[model samples]
Target: MNFAKILRACKGMQWQLSREYAFKSDLKIKWVRPEKIPCTKPEKSGDLGKLPPVNEKEFLLDYKDSRELQSADPIVQSLFQLGNNRCADTARYLREQLIKEVQRHPLDYGSMEAKLARMTVRIRIMQDELEQYPRNTKLKVALKELIDKRKKFLKYLRRWDYRRFEWMLEKLDLVYKPPPAEFHWITRKESLQKLTDAHCEKIKEERLAEYRNMLDEQKIPFLEDAIKKMEFVRKEQIDLEIPVSVTEEQIKDFKRELEALKSKREVKVDSKK
Candidate 1:
């Protein structure tokens, strides 16, 4: 054969493949996928603290501070409180409350507390929306990005002004969960393989225990049969006036072991009953 023929003969050698080239696990087991963490916290009450009072729900605009519609006309006030409070209205109210004490001036929006307060309000609103409509992907993405931005701001605040950072966290009732040093993804194959190994080990232990019990069950019967055989041989030898291989001490030892095994079996049976 020429070199071309030899190459053609070796081309279809699929049977010569080694398992090292492919990712394969010896164990086969099923494992449920872990649930992914959500960007918005629906379970939480809110990051901006508790809800506003029932009576003041409609009048989201600040009546005391802004002096909005300064005249004390009951009809105008009733008109202002006509509709129910929207999320934006609530967020605006909460933002003003958070920034009222911390602001250096009426327009100190650049301050650390003011920035955190804004982010917190938006976060709370988004979380509520997410709870109502969980499948809103665009909102989910926006919330995640906003959360990351807030984390960065919080970290900066912590590094520069730690006292204010502590105050901000307490005021917002927010937990700062820092990102891990490294991120790892969960793979089904690896997880199932680990579970399979553990399952095999458990099965091994169970089967070995059963085999031990089987061996133990046969111990008394084997001892009795051996004692009988030894006695019969000793009797036959004695009748023929020959030397005996089985001694009285050996027979006594077998009888003692048989009695002990029988007592143990009886105890196990009684315990089961």
Candidate 2:
């Protein structure tokens, strides 16, 4: 291995450690997640092509190179095109479309937008290649580097001129995600804890709803008993000529509420059936 490669590796390790410490210390700034967090997310965006890396519409050689001849005779098509280097032709076409308006001059290829456009073409092609041969580590590494480089360019563009950055994103249909202030590992323990908490929350909500239904059921029976008892007491009070505090209006209201609840419960039961 090259000494420079080892040195770079050491630096990378040190950087990761510092980031991890920042995460563990819990003083990092809160980043507003651009998208909802799914139950499972990759360790990093680049690995496994998880970047959700900008969507690119492939430029087809059939359209760019031989659009007029596509509807022409088979003999004419065969004579006009050999059907080789189509991938390269498509990449060139896409690159031109991306950089045509953004380039500083006709000869400009090193501008930020120009480089980004070129990288985007390469990234798109490589991702396509990866789809066929997922075990190609070399291609995967190159693709990851290309993706990371594009991200860096986008980040710089965002800071330098946010308006241009927005325009660039719109043009490329790319989502620019800022580096997270804190990096937390998705450990088994942490994932299980989150899932367990979610499961418990669901169960708690279900149980609470059931408890509420039970209380509701009790209300009808309780109201029936209370009405019977109250009517008996009122009869006795009238017979003894005693003063009454339980008003007829109060009993009527209770009965009305009880009827409404009983009707609602019956509707639910009928629906279930």
Poorly placed runs, candidate 2 (over 4 Å): 1-86, 101-111, 224-256
**What is the C-alpha lDDT profile of model 2 across 1-273, one tens digit per residue?**
999999999999999999977764563233333455321122233323222232233324455455676677766555434243354654676677668767879899898888877786677677768778878889888877777877888888888999988877766666666777999765665665565567668889999999998999989999999888888887888889999867798788889988988998999899999
TM-score of each: 0.51, 0.57
Please report, in order, the local distance difference test score of every candidate based on alpha carbons.
Answer: 0.75, 0.70
Q: Per-residue lDDT of 1-273 in model 1, one digit per residue for the tens?
A: 799988876764553444423424443454789887665663322254644443552564655434655565766666555255455665677677767766769989998788877877777778778878989999989998888889899889889988888887887787776677899888996786688678889999999988987898988789999999989999999999998888999999999999988998899899999
How far is each candidate from the true structure, as Cα RMSD in Å?
10.0, 14.9
